[model samples]
Target chain A: MIKENIAFKNLFVTVGTTKFSKLIDTITKKEVLDILQSLGITFVQLQTGKDFPGPKLDPNVEQLCSIRSESGSYTVELEKKITLKYNEYFEDFNNEIEKSDLVISHAGAGTCLEVLHKKKPLLVVINEDLMDNHQMELAEELENQGYLYHCTCNTLVQALKQDFSALKHYSKPEKFVFSRFLDKCIGLSDGK
Target chain B: MLRLLQGLNFKNYTPRYYFIASSDTTSLSKIKELEQSVEKHKQGEYHICKIPRSRVVNQSYITSIFTTLYAILYSIPLVFKIVPDLILCNGPGTCIPVCGLGFLLKTLFIKDVKIVFVESFCRTRTLSLSGKILLYLADVFVVQWMCLKDRIQRADYIGQLM
Candidate 1:
C-alpha cells in the first residue's frame, strides 16, 4: 500500500471528447474534473476532434492544482488561459500519454486497452448510459484483470478523495495479451 | 499403428465452433441476468436458472413485416441448440429483430446455457442499408476487438466460430 506520505504530485487524467459521441456533456465533464481535484492530481484531458467546445475544470479544481483541460474545441474559459489549438496531431498527444503516470479514460475498451498496454496505470470511467452497455463491460474486465480501476463518476470521485496512491498501487501484475485475437484477425492458424 | 492414426485423427479433427448469437435491446437485461446465473453456477451454486423474456417484435402497419419477423425469430431456436458453452452475440442495435425470439425461448426452456454478445459495429463508419438495420437491433454492438475482455457483457472474442 503506497500510503500518501510524500507530497503526491504529477498525476494526469485524460477525458475523451470526440464529438463522435455526444455523451460528454457538462455534467460528465464536471464529474471527471471533480474526481481529479479530490485526488490532488495534475490533469490533462484529450478532445478527440474539433467538433464541440472544450470546458474548463470546475473553479475549485482550477484553484487547487495545475489542471489543463486541453481540447480541439473552439470555446474557452475566461478565468483560465488554457489555449485551444486546431492541430490534429498525435505526436504531442502520444508524448503526453507517455508522460502521464496514471490515466483516467472513457470506456471505449479498445482504446483504453491500447493505452493500458503502454504499462501505465489506468482508471477507466464507463458512461452508464451507453445504449449498448459496452463501456461498462470493458472497464469491469480491465478491473478484474488487475490492471485498471473501474468506476462510475460518483464512485470514482469518492475513490479519489480516499487515496489516489492506493488505487494506483492496486494495478495487477498480469500482462494484457491480444495475440489470440490478432492471430484470428490476420488469418494465421496452425493447421490441426 | 492403426490405433495411433485413429487417436491422431480425433485430436486433429475436433471441430471448434463459436456461435455469435445476436440479441436486441429488449433481450439485453435477460442476457445480463443469465451471465450472472452462469457465474453463480461456476461458483458451485445449484440449479441455476436463466431469466426469461417474451418475444414481441414491433411492426409498422404497412404490411406483414411483424409477422415475418416473428416467424424468422421463432424458428431460429428450434433449429439451434442451447447447449453451446461459449455463445457470443453481436448487437446493441438489431440482432434482436431476428434472434430475440430464439433467445427468449431458449432461456425459458433450456438449462445451463451461457450466451455472450459482441457489439461489432461502429456506427461512425456508414454501413450498408441492411447492415444499418441490423446494427440498431444487435444484442451487443462491438467496435474494437480487444474490448471484448469485459465480462457479463461478453465483449471478449473467444475466436470466430468454424
Candidate 2:
C-alpha cells in the first residue's frame, strides 16, 4: 500500500509518433481529470503526436514552451500549471521521461521498452483503432508477464486510480541479446 | 545493433555500424536517439543512411518504381565503399534494397559479407513483405516466434527480442 503522503505528482503522457486520439480523449475525461487532481499530480507533460485534436486548454492552466536562442541557448518558458503539446515531438524526450514519476503511453514496442528500460512505472493504453491490432497483442503479453499495466479507454480511469506501488519492478534481461547476436554475426563474418 | 557493436573489443577489426532508415520523423528521431546514446557513452563509429520511404499500401506504381530505383542507386556506392564483413538488418521495406545490395556484392563482386536478418516481433502470425523476400537473401534468417519457425524453412527461432 502506498503511504498517503507519497503519491506520484508528475506524469509523462505520450501517444507515440503516431496519434492515438482515443487514448488522448480518455485522459481528458472529467472523471480522469478529477482523479489526477485529487491524487496531487500537479504536472503533466504531454507529447501528442500528429493528428490528435488536443483537449481544450483551460485559460488558467499553465503552459510551458522550450525555445532555442540564436546562439543555441535552450530555455523553457513556464507560464501555466498544465502543459499540452499538440502534434509535435519533444526535443528532449528522454529528459521528459526522466523527470516524470509515471508514464502514460500508447502501446508501441519502442515506447514500452524505453519506459521499462528506465524502470519507470508505465501504464500502456492500447489503441484498438490501429489497422494491424498487433499493439494489443504486445500490450497484453507484457501485462500478463507483469512487466507493465495495460488498459483500453474503458479501463484507463480505473487503472490510473490503482495502487501502482504494488506493481512489479520490471527486471531487464541480464544478457544483452543484441550483443550476443552481433557476436554470432562477427563469427560468421570471420568464416569468410 | 549500434549499442552492441560499441561494447565489442574490436582487436584487429575496425567495427563500423551502419544504419539504413526511411526518411520519416519517427525513424529520424530514433536515429537521433541512437546517435546521442553512442555519443554519451563514447561508443563505436557509426553512419546513418536515409532511404526514400516506400510502401505497397497507398503508393502509386510510378512513385514506387522511382523510390526503388533511388534506394538501389544510393546503396550501390555505400555497399561498395563500406564493403562490410557483415550486414545486420531487421524486416522493413528500407532494408530490402540494402540487403539486396549486400547480396549483389557477394554474388557479383565476390565480396565476402554475411547478411543476417531478424524478423520483427510484430510478425507473430505472418511474415512481413520484407521478411518474405529476405528469406532468400539473408545468410542467417532469425524469427522471434516459434510459430514462424515452421513456416520459414531456413529461419532460426531465437525467441522474442524484448
- Docking model 2 quality class: acceptable
Taking all chains together, each candidate's TM-score versus the true structure is: 0.41, 0.72
- DockQ, in order, for the candidates? 0.03, 0.26
Q: Which pairs of residues collide in candidate 2? A: A62-A80, A62-A81, A63-A80
lDDT of 2 at A65: 37
lDDT by residue for model 1 (B29-148), tens: 443454344333233321212222122223333444554465455546543543432223343223333344444545678533333333342222223232344343334333333432
Per residue, candidate 1 scores C-alpha lDDT tens digits across A56-128 of: 3456534543423344433323234232222222434456567766666667644574566566666666666
Q: Model 1: residues >4 Å from true position, as ranges?
A: A5-12, A15-40, A43-49, A54-93, A161-192, B1-162
Docking quality level of the chain pair in candidate 1: incorrect
The C-alpha local distance difference test score for the whole of candidate 2 amounts to: 0.67
Give the CA lDDT, 0 to 100, for residue A191 in model 1: 30
